[model samples]
Target: MSMNPITFTPIGVIHSPHKSKEGTPIQPSRLQRSSGEVEIFSEFRPGLRDLEGFSKIFLIFHLHAMQESQLEVTPYLDDQTRGVFATRAPSRPNPIGLSLVDLFSIDNGILKVGGLDILDGTPLLDIKPFIPDIDHAEGIKVGWLEDKTHHFRNHQADDRF
Candidate 1:
């Protein structure tokens, strides 16, 4: 298939305590109780209607800080080098990032979220409600990550890319 270039206008920005990726948690699951704010642009405020009801929301953002792309990466949880698509390394062709965070409340055009693992001032591309009935799966195969997730809570991101 032919590849096509796509442009995305960020609708918002993410605000968190993490100023750099070096010490940031690699995933939301690694940072319990972490809090952050999502400030939706005024023009997109209307799209957030009824979003407060959801317990979790998927924050799709751009990895604007990723300076380069890599095809193979040594994942944070593993020592083996693997294809970039198989890992969640920030360096990618598109540099798009996604995280499922706990939705606390929506006040005005800002949303309070928990367990966020994104960097401060990250561009927010989109937000979607997470429904367990449709998003969660049973007997899911994690491939190489099967037995390596036990220590995610203590792992921190480094300047590997």
Candidate 2:
């Protein structure tokens, strides 16, 4: 087996009030009132045509500041160590973070968004509109997440990353 190397250029930057990770919400749902902006590069501005119709968009980004990856971790809101894939902790092998944020509006290439849990100045890889009919699944199982549902809103990332 071989590992293939790939490269990417950030389309733009994410502007959020969250300058640090210490007090930022661990999930978008917990930060409904917080607002942010996505500044898509001028070259990619044309790609956003008709995107305003969607209420939310998925942001795929790199955990730029994360130093390393781990296979097992004690995630935020839980004391037990679990396989890294089972948790949303940022320090994964890929170090990619996905956030489904609310789209308030779009003017030119700047998108007004809210409910962002990502760090300020994170490198964005791509943005995809969230369509409920296609993205939502019924009768799904959450595995270990079932017991941690109640703590999601209050959770904050610890040093586990």
Candidate 3:
């Protein structure tokens, strides 16, 4: 088998108070008070049209600070090692992080948002409005996470990842 390389150019940068990976919340739901801004490039400014009507937006970004990739990792919240896809660990085949953030406002190309769990200066790939009717499901299976869901509320990103 063969693999082909792909390239992606960041459309923006996410500015957050989390300068380092340590001590940052592992998920956006845990970072209720953390605020940040997404500075979209001028070329992508037109994409923000009519997005303000939504209460939340999905931010897809690159884990720029992650040093290496791993297929199996012991995530921040758990001591047991799990496959990369099972957890939101930064080390993966593609270091992409997705967070649903509150849409405070949009001024020109900059978007003010809250509930940020990403590291400062993370490269932004794309943004999409959160539409409950389309994105939400009535019943979902969380697989191995079912047992650990209770602990997620207080989980913070440790140095494990």
Candidate 4:
């Protein structure tokens, strides 16, 4: 590894109706009506040119509200403790969150999206077009998340992390 600290600056900020962390959905797919907007900084506006063609986009953002991180955590759906890497717990070594949201429209530097599960003002790190050909798989193992995933739709986050 390079003995240098890597750094990232926010290219934009996310705006959502979910103001706090306490009640936000754990995953984007769980909240179909949760819509939000991503405001890209003016300097990065040109980067949004061809992105409008894609129906979905991956929002790579920082969990700015996270107070701290733990190596192991008891995740939202399960009662058992798990390594941070094995779960999508917000309290991670790196407080980064990735969500695949539906891109409804893009106007100026603002992108309107649905299926958003982020907090009010999360800092966006990057955005990538979601190409179905490369992003999806027909059959795959879900590890320990198999049985727990069925409960995600009705569950909302709390301060447990």
Q: Which one is best on TM-score?
A: 1
Instruction: Give the distance in Å from residue 7's predicted Cα in candidate 2 to where it truly belongs.
Output: 0.6
TM-score, per-candidate, Cα-based: 0.95, 0.94, 0.93, 0.94
Residue lDDT tens for model 1, 1-161: 97789999999999998999988888896245669899999999999999989989999999999999999989898889999998888999999999999998999999999887799999999999999999999998888888887777767798886
lDDT digits (tens) for residues 37-113 of candidate 4: 99999999999999999999999999999999999999988888999999989998789999999999999999999
- Model 2: which ten-residue window has the lowest total lDDT? 152-161
* lDDT over C-alpha atoms for residue 116 of model 3: 88
lDDT for residue 139 in candidate 3, whole number 0-100: 79
CA lDDT for candidate 3: 0.86
User: Candidate 3 residues 63-140, lDDT tens each?
Assistant: 989889999888775778899898888898888899998989999999999888889999999998898989999778
Model 4 TM-score on a 0 to 1 scale:
0.94
* lDDT, residue 51, model 2: 95
**Alpha carbon deviation, residue 153, candidate 4 (Å):** 2.6
Question: How high is the CA lDDT of each candidate model?
Answer: 0.90, 0.86, 0.86, 0.90
Clashing pairs in 1: none
Query: Over the stretch 1-161, how does candidate 2's per-residue lDDT look in tens digits?
Result: 87887889898889888888777778886444668899999998898999999999999998898888989988887778989999888889888999999999999899999888888999888999998899999998888788777777766665556
RMSD of 4: 1.5
